[model samples]
Target: MRNVILCVMGVALLSGCSWAKNVQSSKNRVYFENLYFPARLSTNSDDKQSFTVSVDRIDQGLAPAREAGRYEATKYCVATYGNSDVAWVAGPDAPDSELRIVEGRLQFEGRCDV
Candidate 1:
């Protein structure tokens, strides 16, 4: 009797979930040319507007990594300050020689222009 009840509960739980659907929505998926690059944005403790974005796996491609970093920084500024204007200290528009890449990761620095 206990086994029968457990089996029914498990089936009920499984019915509510869809295995075919993507775990992450398209809106949240960050990718360049179907390749997903991991990016992280960190804000300064003393100044919330100042931020640094790091995108990993430069071995994949530099342009994509730069786009990923730009995307992350833009997302952060928009979310925090309700604006997209950014005063980049070191950003994507710079020439290749001016860009900073350390240990296979691209780095970007900026402050939200509110």
Candidate 2:
């Protein structure tokens, strides 16, 4: 019946919303929220050319999330040093977390090739 279909759809939608809420609360939302999406960059020394990038979750997909960290690092390198060349000294992959979700944090460290 039409009513039955409508009720089922409503329940599905509500459940989806609930799952999202649970996921949000289950992870380090507060920690991630404080950081910039894709990546957060900071210099490691007073030279101002050597930098590091700390990356948070990418909701699109896990693979993209991993690559986003690299992309972000490269972007930062180019912006700061006029070249996209960069070498990551740490963390292009997501480490294990309590939630076990498809989200993660990534980090990279290196100097601009300039």
lDDT of each: 0.88, 0.62
RMSD of 1: 3.0
Given candidate 2, what's the lDDT at residue 72? 68
lDDT for each residue of candidate 1 in 2-111, tens digit (9 for 90 to 100)? 99999999987786564424454545778887788899999999999999999898889888888888889889888888999999999988999999988878999999
Candidate 2 per-residue lDDT, tens place, 1-114, comes to 999999999999999999999998757332223343555678866867677766665554545545656666677777767888765455455353521233355556666677
In candidate 2, stretches whose alpha carbon ends up further than 4 angstroms from where it belongs are 1-37, 58-60, 91-104
Screening candidate 1 with a backbone cut-off below 3 angstroms (N, C-alpha, C), the clashing residue pairs are none
Per-candidate TM equals 0.82, 0.48
Residue 71 accuracy (lDDT) in model 2: 69
- Pairs that clash in candidate 2: none
Worst 10 residues of 2 by lDDT: 28-37
Best prediction by lDDT: 1
Q: Per the 3 Å backbone cut-off, how many clashing residue pairs does candidate 2 have?
A: 0
